[model samples]
Target: MSCVQTFADYGFRALGIGERALPKTDITLCEQVVLIGSGMFWNIYFALLALLLGFVAASLVAFARNSTRAILWRPAAIFIFILRGSPLFLQFFLIYETFVLLPKVGFDLNLGFVDITVETRWLTRAWLGALIVLFLNTTAYTAQIFYGALRSVPKGEIEAALAMGMTPNQINRRIIWPTMLRLAWPSYTNEAIFLFHATALVFFSSFPAWQQKGDALYYASYFADKTFNPFVPYPIIAVFFIAFTLLIILIFGFFQRRLNRHL
Candidate 1:
């Protein structure tokens, strides 16, 4: 097929449109680009949502770990240890199995005024199941970074706040939190990049790619498998990833600069 023809066939393949099965032997360059690019949608989706949710969860975990009370710090420390100590690949498997063991029917939620059912079945799908894994994985990693950065926050600042008769909660809100984030921004930037790279593994792990709608690496590997040519598709995946990584760095770097402006 000509380049134009190949593009036409695979252009919408990623979206579950156009030719459904993907190209087999003698895959054209356009097919590789369009199909793989389509798959990139999943990568971006996973990275963005995971990072956003993870940042919030990590912030809470950081505070909990830093809390003086054993009630707060111990659980935070254990959660971080388990997630960080175990390989993410293994965690993916573990979480997927645990979810599978959940009642196939939805779980019931009781809010004093209303009862709602949350579906457990959705947890089996890669989009939601794999996302939850990445969310928690990045949360644990980012929390550690924030916790380390928290140590660098000035003790005098908190002391001064206390001297001024400020409550601990106020000190945390008005002083510690911002400083911790400012100090942690650089490290957190690295965590974000790593999480994006990890998105490629979502499909390869316990979560099966429903409808073959996987991430960039998944589709790239698919084409490589069919053509027995890793040289082309894999490089393509790397390039796409590099581009996204640079974009991430630029964004986070901007925040890093703003955070450090007072320095």
Candidate 2:
């Protein structure tokens, strides 16, 4: 069967869709390609959402780190240091354990006139927990990128804005931020590609892959175990990853062009 038909038979089978059982004795190259490509769907989902949301948070943290007050600057500095200094692999393990210890029934909040219960157990699972870790991790890395760009913003640009009676916020919004993003685009692009590759570490960390459904790396590992041939499935996965990385570069290259349009 063609890869498309193989996917049709088993794509969502990871989530119990068309096939009740995965391939056993007769696993073929086509099946490996289709299933691994299907798993890439989840990897893209996680990376895209985390990067989009984390970019805003990172910019704010970068701004706070550059603030005049010691109170604002100190915490931001320490947060960036702690996150960047430690191994992300360790962070994933620690966070998963911490989330697992929380009350299964969740915590209750008492407003003046109302009570609310927030569920915390779902965080112990791979999906939510891994997403949270990746989000915070990328935010810290991107914040440092933004911070460096913030420092490199031309002093004359700010002075000119002030001379024109531009308020502080207006100067930042209109002049400083855009330029910083433009200057930081190349390094930021590298960070983004690395973060997507890092999603492979999720299953290997403390978070459990519920129901055997997992990312591309997880399935690649499974096939390697069954067939005892690292050559076929793993190389197929690497090609998929290479294609995915190229797609990211293409998308971000378009943004880089827009950022540098006037230059």
Candidate 3:
């Protein structure tokens, strides 16, 4: 079968889609390509979900860091510094260890007459654990970008908004937030691209792949080990990642235009 056909058969099979078992022996280059491509799906999922969720948290952090009160400002500033200053690789390792140490039975909460058990074991897995790490990591990076943008917002805009009798929250929502996003878009684009590439480190960190299911780099590493040929699979993954990175740029570029529409 062709690579595409094989992918059709085993695409999400990692997640139990079509095939139950991955091909073992006589693995052709086509199989490698198809399987690695399939694995990229998870990478894309993590990056997109983390970025989308991180944006809101980042905005909140950015605003808090810029607050006049020292209480809000200090904690937010510390969070941004700690996450941004340390390597993301270390963060992943630390978070995974922390998650693993949590009780496998999960945590329980009693609210009035209702009792809820919150699962903690799943946080040790790559899907949820690594995602939480990536989410917090990206939030820190994006918050710093947004904080800088918030500082650089033109003084006249604030003055104009205040003159119009806008409330502090109204001024921020209408005038401040939009401009901050616009100003930060380019740098934020770069952060997002790097963050996607960083997802490769997930499997290598404390999180296990569970079975053979893994992201592109995980599979590419497997092929490299089996064939003793980093030359083929690794480069193929690089090209795929570069193409994926370009797609991210294009998508963000469209938003950049939309954000700057009034300007």
Candidate 4:
């Protein structure tokens, strides 16, 4: 088939939207490129959602870790310790197996007006299960970065805010939080890059891709296994990841400039 036709056929195969069967025989360069490019959508999806949700959770955890109360800080510290201490690949396997062991019927919630049954079966799928792992892992990592930045916020600025008769809330909102973000952003940018690159791990994890809808690495592996030539397909994966990583840098760099614009 022509390249354009190949693209039309397999362009979105990774999403379960296109052809049911991947090109099994007589695979062409066009087929590999198009299918692999299509598979990148999952990597982007995992990274984008994880980073967005993880950022909010990390911010909250950072504040908790910074709190003087042991009740707040201790749990936060332990959470960060556990997540950061463990290997992500192991976390994926454990979480997936745990989810599998849960009762298939899932938990039922009772309210005066009605009852709701939350499903557990969905947790075995990569879309939701792998996502939860990524979210928690990044949250632990990013929370530490933010906590350090929070600690590094200049004491002089706090004193100035106090002298200005700013309330604690006002000081935090105006002086502390903004400065923490600013100080943390450079390192956070690195974390974001790492998280994006880490999305590739989802394919290898215990979370199963439904209907053969896998990520870029998944398709690359498929092509390599079929063709028995690692040189071609594996490099394609690297090239695609490198290009996407650069795009991530450009996007994050724009925000980095904005954060440091005053300096």
Question: Which candidate wins on lDDT?
Answer: 4
What TM-score does prediction 3 earn?
Answer: 0.93
RMSD, each candidate, Å?
Answer: 2.8, 2.9, 2.6, 2.4
Per-residue lDDT of 125-242 in model 2, one digit per residue for the tens? 7778899999999999999999999999999999999999999999989999998999888999999998999898888778777877778888899899999999998999999999
What is model 1's C-alpha RMSD?
Answer: 2.8
Candidate 3: pairs in clash? none
Best by TM-score: 4
Per-residue lDDT tens digits of candidate 3, residues 1-263?
77778878777755657776777677788878877887898789889989999999999999999999999999999999999999998999888888878778867889989998878887988899999999999999999999999999999999999999999989999999998998899999999998999888888777898887889988888888888888989988988899999999999999999998877
Which stretch of 10 consecutive residues in model 1 shows the poorest summed lDDT? Answer: 9-18
- Model 1 misplaced regions, further than 4 Å: 1-9, 107-117
> Candidate 1 lDDT (Cα, whole model)?
0.89
For model 3, the run of ten residues with the poorest summed lDDT: 13-22
Give TM per candidate: 0.91, 0.93, 0.93, 0.94
**How accurate locally is residue 42 in candidate 1, as Cα lDDT from 0 to 100?**
88
Q: How well is each residue in 1-263 modelled by candidate 4, as lDDT tens digits? A: 79998888898898898789987899889899999999999999999999999999999999999999999999999999999999999999999999999888867889878998778898988999999999999999999999999999999999999999999999988999899999998889889889988899998878777788999999999999999989888888899999988998899889888878989
Candidate no. 4 TM-score: 0.94
lDDT agreement with native, every candidate: 0.89, 0.88, 0.89, 0.92
lDDT of 1 by residue, 130-236 (tens): 99999999999999999998988999999999999999889988899899998888888899999999999998888988777777888998988898879999999
